[model samples]
Target: MEKPTRLALLKEIAEFLNEETETYDMMQGALKFLIDGSDFTTGWIFFIDNEGNHGLVSDTNLPGALVKNNCQYMQEGTCWCVQAYSNEKLTKASNIINCSRINLATKAHYQETDGITHHATVPLRSGREQFGLLNVATPYTKSYSEEDLELLESVAFQIGSAIKRIWLTDQEKEAARINERNRLARDLHDSVNQMLFSVKLTAHAAKAMSKEEMSKNAFNTIETTSQQAVNEMRALIWQLKPIGLEHGLINALSSYSEMMKLNLNVQVDGLINVPSLIEENVYRILQEAINNVKKHAHTDEIYLKLSQQQNYLNIEFEDNGSGFNINHNTEHVSHGLNNMRQRVKMINGKINIQSSYEQGTKINLIIPIKVD
Candidate 1:
């Protein structure tokens, strides 16, 4: 490519990346632009995190037959370039190392094209953190020169910066969402919830003073509706605010149980301080479980046990109630249970539910804790 054309291609890639909303889309755009404008026949990118875990984030024009196998490898395979980058051995663009994924793909296809047998990779980094690796493959046998290396390194730098920007933007959006939720919670609790409570109290007094049977019944209905409304509004506020978790997870669960009129027995055996992310997830999972019991358990008492044992946090919730079978394929199954499972999985936790006809239900969850 000529000087003007090369410059224009780089500029176009940057502009397209800037317009992308998601990191995956940005990476796909970058790879596609590189293959079309440069001499590269195929391209792919991989992201590595602090845990030495690497996975493919984007790729360009993979063969239909190889897509499934390639994706599996992308998630499970790690190349020499990635290892070198992680070990701080390969920082600049280089063609000295061969990609393991490409080698595997070539071997799998006996009639492989000679155009894209190997690839060169550059580490994408921002400051001290390695964001990922950018790989470009060509058919020509000629080795990549210093100029090619420099150009690839420049492209890597741009990609790293874009990834960082996307992260920051997502953080800002989340913060804004939390702030808005807090504001709404405060307004609802202070205004609507308070009024509902007052209305219930007034109805109770009217019911007591009324002598006519019809009037007393009407007052009783008013009081019941107002109480239900107040309870629902308060629950909504908790969902929006979640400030109760700051006091402690145990306390939050106790308070929520009281609000739902369920007799809750809580047992704590060990230290409870954990990361906020873990704490929030545990709280939500328990909340969903408690809710499921309230709606379907047909029992008034719930027993909860929380403990930390050997680098893992264990939680148990048991209730003696009308039990039902768990059908995984049924759409009518409790969404609450499904949501609880999803939350546990997000934190890399394990959950088990035991239930049978007239046998009651037991929920056991275990989550790994990061020890400092």
Candidate 2:
């Protein structure tokens, strides 16, 4: 590549990063720009997450078969470049170490001969912290020069800075979400919750003192509704903090059921404490399940059974209510069921729902849990 062209490519990549607010989008744009500017046929970016796990972040300009094979190899196997980069031995752009994914790709395709699979890698870094590796591969005839290496290094720096900026933006958004939740929690506790409490107390006294039948019935209704609202507000406040979830999953599910005005029966056998992350997912799944029941079940009673058998945790939520046909595509079947399914899958769990006209509904979830 010429001097002017290299500078133009770098500027274009920077502009592309400027337009992107998401990390993955920036990565895809950067990879496309790098491959388009150079003689490289295809390229991919490998990023190390905050947990120090190495994985492919973005890829471009590769055939479907080649991309699949390379992605699988990279996911399952190790790379010398990434290992050396982690150890601080491979910071700058270098052609000294080759790529194992490229070697695998060559073996899969006979056309990729001995020298055609070679690639150059540079560390994507900002200051002293390296985020990932940028890889560009071309055939033997179009081998990279020193200038190409310098240009890739400069591109890596720009991408690294963009990645950091995207990360910071995510952190800010999460902080904002937490702050808003706290504000809502405080407002509910200070105003609505207190008023509900007062109403409940006044209604209770009025119910006891009233002699007329109509006045006593009115007071009784007021007391019951006010109590229900207060309970719901309390649950909402706890959801913002998720305080009791750290204690146990069963307790959290029971409390959530009470808030929904459901007569919940909890049965547990051989249960053990799981990680907080898994517990959080479990709580979310249960909450969604209860909401689905309240919205569609038309019943105020639920049976919940949780058991730890073998290496998995099994939970069953059953309700005897008006059920819909499962054969036809029903609108109610998609939203809550899909949300529950996604929550289960996020924690490597499985969920099954069985429902039919007037037969009620039963949902069973089997989640693999690690016991300490």
Candidate 3:
């Protein structure tokens, strides 16, 4: 590529990155664009999380051997570039003489490599934070010139900066959501919740003083309805702000279960210390689980256990209720399950639910803890 062409491509990539808001879409699009516009015929990007686990997030024009079995080889094991990256040795664009994945394909007699044997590897980073690696290859290319390496480094920098920008934006959005929830919770408590309380008090007073039986009955009904409304409004407020969570997750959950009129048996085997985000998510998920039991379980008691083993936190909920088929495919059940799954996924966790008719229901959650 010419100097002017390289500069133009970089400008285009910057503009493209600015226009993209989603991380995966931006990465996939950028990889395709880079390969299409440059001399490289294949490219891929890996994303390394805080715990040093890497995953292939984007790729383009992968050869048949690598693409076989849905790119099992690339996704499964570490390669030379990845090892160099983890060791902090691959800081800039440089030649990788022996790509491990490619070599594996060659040794296995997979001849669909498209003549690719080596690739240029660059660490994708912004300042002090390292994201992952970017590797690009062309057929029969053994080494990259200084200019070529420089161009790759520039593109990698662009990608790293874009990744950081998107991450910060997501953080800002989550902060905004939490702020909005707090505001709404406050408004409901001060207005609707207080009004319902007042209505309940007035009805109870009227019922106590009523002379006519009909009037007494009317007052009693009003009192009951207002009380139910107050309880529901309180539950909504708890979901929004989780008032007692600052004290501890167990305390908050116990308080919530009491409010919901469910008997909860708790057993904990390990110390409960985690980030606030994880606590909040767990609290929310358990709230839903308890609600499900109350509405469908035909039982009023729940068995809860929590334990920490190694770097994982495990939680289990069991109830001897009239459980339903897991594959029932009901709209409400599907939505609730999907919501729980999404919350767990956000924290890189896993959830499993088991239930059958005439039997009981059990839910298990496993969340990985990151240690610094």
Candidate 4:
């Protein structure tokens, strides 16, 4: 190709690949056009960045793509493109090197055009910056022309412009996601958790100053109201901010031990060991089970145990207090129990309640570790 014609091709590329959103796909189609219209069979595009690393951008009709945090791939075994990149060569290559496979890639990538044999890759450079690369390869020993190099450079200018646009768009989306998470955290702390604390304080005061004195009826009412407030706060804490197991299930359970002792006047023990995500769900389920014990079961003594068995984590919560009919409608228990069921479903677990009038309510939560 003549100099005037070569310059015109670059200008044409700029016009076609300049769109804001279509840059990535434009880079993809441009590589295909270079091989099909120019003197090459297989084409690979790469960008040599500030740190002298290869960043594979796009390819034509290939299955495996090279994954990169920020780099490209080298095709020549001795890496002609690296040298061209370092030297900032306008257009150059070895006749012998083009006839051989470019094992110059740092590692074997999924996008290896296994059928490619002879190849030519041009390092894309603009002053001190190495933007990207463009190349054409063939299975036969035929030599590529100088005309091909000029055309590849033309494609490089357009493809490089498109790549820069893609990078900017990605950066914008990531920044937006970070901002959203920050806003969510602030809302939870400022509104939800603070209100729960106020409710807890008021309930505790009512329990203490109530004129129940020693009357079982008035005393029981005061105790139940305070306990209900505490349970509500526990659920709110779990929702507002899920503690990342820094405070394990045992710590969460221990906080409730005094309540079991005071309300039912029973002895309770808790054991726990499991992975973070699954175990967190277990903590929530047990908390709800304890709330149920206080609200309706009227049990004097309660037992809560958590430990890992063969294939699953077992949670046993038993109460010696007045048991209720398990067959009775669970609609009234929807808030806590339903929430537990929904959470258990997410972690692939099961909850079994065994109780009737005198039998006492025992909640068994089994969470499977190995889920498909």
With a 3 Å backbone cut-off (N, CA, C), the pairs that clash in candidate 4 are: 46-133, 47-132, 54-71, 54-72, 55-71, 55-72, 56-72, 75-102, 76-104, 299-321
lDDT per residue, candidate 1, 1-372, as tens digits? Answer: 443366787898888878876777888888888788877767788877544567677988654323655466566767787788888898789885565765676677635545565668898877775777898877754477776777788788888888777766764564576678879998998899999999999999999999999999999999999999997887799888675777999988888888889989999997877777678678878888777778887998999999998778999999998878875323434677877876665565678888876777899998878611
TM-score of each: 0.70, 0.63, 0.73, 0.42
For candidate 2, write residues 258-340 as lDDT tens digits: 76788888888875666665676677778877887788879888889988877788899898988766556367767767768
Q: Write the per-residue lDDT of candidate 3 for residues 1-372, one digit (tens) a residue.
A: 353388888988999999998777998888877888788999999876544557888999998888877787788888777777777877789999887888887666568989888889888888888888888999898997888788899999999999878767764675577779889999999999999999999999999999999999999999999999998998789889888888998888889888889999999997978877678778878888888888888998899999988888899999999988997846887788877876665565768899999798999998877511
State in Å the error of residue 257, model 2.
11
The whole-model lDDT of each prediction reads 0.77, 0.76, 0.84, 0.57
By TM-score rank, best first, the candidates go 3, 1, 2, 4
Could you give candidate 4's per-residue lDDT for residues 98-197 as a string of tens digits? 4222443323552554555456666554433345666666655456677765566567655665665654564455346445644665576567656655
Candidate 4: deviation at residue 217, Å? 14
Better of 1 and 2 by TM-score: 1
Q: Whose lDDT is greatest here?
A: 3
Clashes, model 2:
0
By TM-score, the better pick of 2 and 3 is: 3
- Alpha-carbon RMSD, each predicted model: 6.6, 8.7, 5.3, 17.5
